[model samples]
Target: MHETEVVGLNVQRRRRGWPTLDIGPFFMFFGIAGTDHGREARMERRFEQEYFSNAVTLHLASALSPGTYALHGLPEEANKRGWTVGPQGGNPTGHLSADGLDELRGWMRRTPSQRDRRVRPERMLPPA
Candidate 1:
C-alpha cells in the first residue's frame, strides 16, 4: 500500500481514539493508548507495519505518523535483525491472516484519496 494511505488511516483512527491494526508477515502488533487529560492519556492506539525485509523498516517508518508506533512483522526477521514489535517493542499480538489482509486491502480501496497532504510539495514532481 502507498505510504500516504497508511498515514491517513492512522490519523483517522487516532482522531477517533481507536486501535490501529498492524499486519506483518510473521506477526502483528496492536497499540492502545491511555485515556487521560494529561499528555499520557488512556487512548487506544493500534497500527500495523509489515517487515518483509530490512528495507521495509525505512519504508514503514517513512509512512508512519510522527509518534511512537507499534510494529509487527516476522519473528525471524526481528531476531536476525534485532528488531522489535508491539506497544513496548516486545512480542506480536497476532498474525494477519490472508482474509485479514484482504479486508485491509478493501479498506484501502474504499478510502477517498491516498496522499499525505503534509508531505506533498507545492510543485509537482518531475518539474511538472
Candidate 2:
C-alpha cells in the first residue's frame, strides 16, 4: 500500500516494461524511446536543443511504455567520467552490480508506507 511498495511491485511486475538508464547525477525515466536510429536521432536533437552537454546514461524502454528512464551521477561528466560505470548497491551508476538492483527493489517496495506516514495533505497548508 505504500508508495515505495507500490513502486517495487510495479518494478517487479513490470520489470520487462521498466527500462532504467544512468544519465549523470540522477536516474531519468525513459519509456517512450525505441531502440532505433530514429529514436537516437530524436534524443540527440533533444539533447542539443536542451543544451545537455553533461554525460548521461540513457535507458530506453522496449515495452509499450510512455516514458524513458535516465540517471545522472555527478555535477558534470568531466568531473565524474573517470568513475566506474555499472550498477552497484541499488544504484544504476556504480558498476551495474546486482546488489544495487536489489537495493533499489527493496527501496521501491518500502517507500510508499514511509511516505504515507511522513506526508499528509494538511501538512502543505500554511502554519496558523
Root-mean-square deviation of each candidate, in angstroms? 18.5, 18.2
Estimate candidate 1's alpha-carbon lDDT, on a 0 to 1 scale: 0.29
Q: Write the per-residue lDDT of candidate 2 for residues 34-61, one digit (tens) a residue.
A: 3444656666555543342232222212
Q: Which ten residues in a row have the lowest lDDT in candidate 1?
A: 118-127
**TM per candidate:** 0.21, 0.20
What is the alpha-carbon RMSD of candidate 2 to the true structure?
18.2
lDDT of 1 at 11: 15
**What C-alpha lDDT do the candidate models reach, one value each?**
0.29, 0.28
Task: Enumerate clash totals for all models, in the order shown.
Answer: 16, 37
Q: What is the lDDT of residue 28 in candidate 2?
A: 27
| Regions of candidate 2 where Cα sits further than 4 Å from its true position | 1-69, 72-95, 115-128
Q: Deviation in angstroms for 82 in model 2?
A: 14
Candidate 2 global lDDT: 0.28
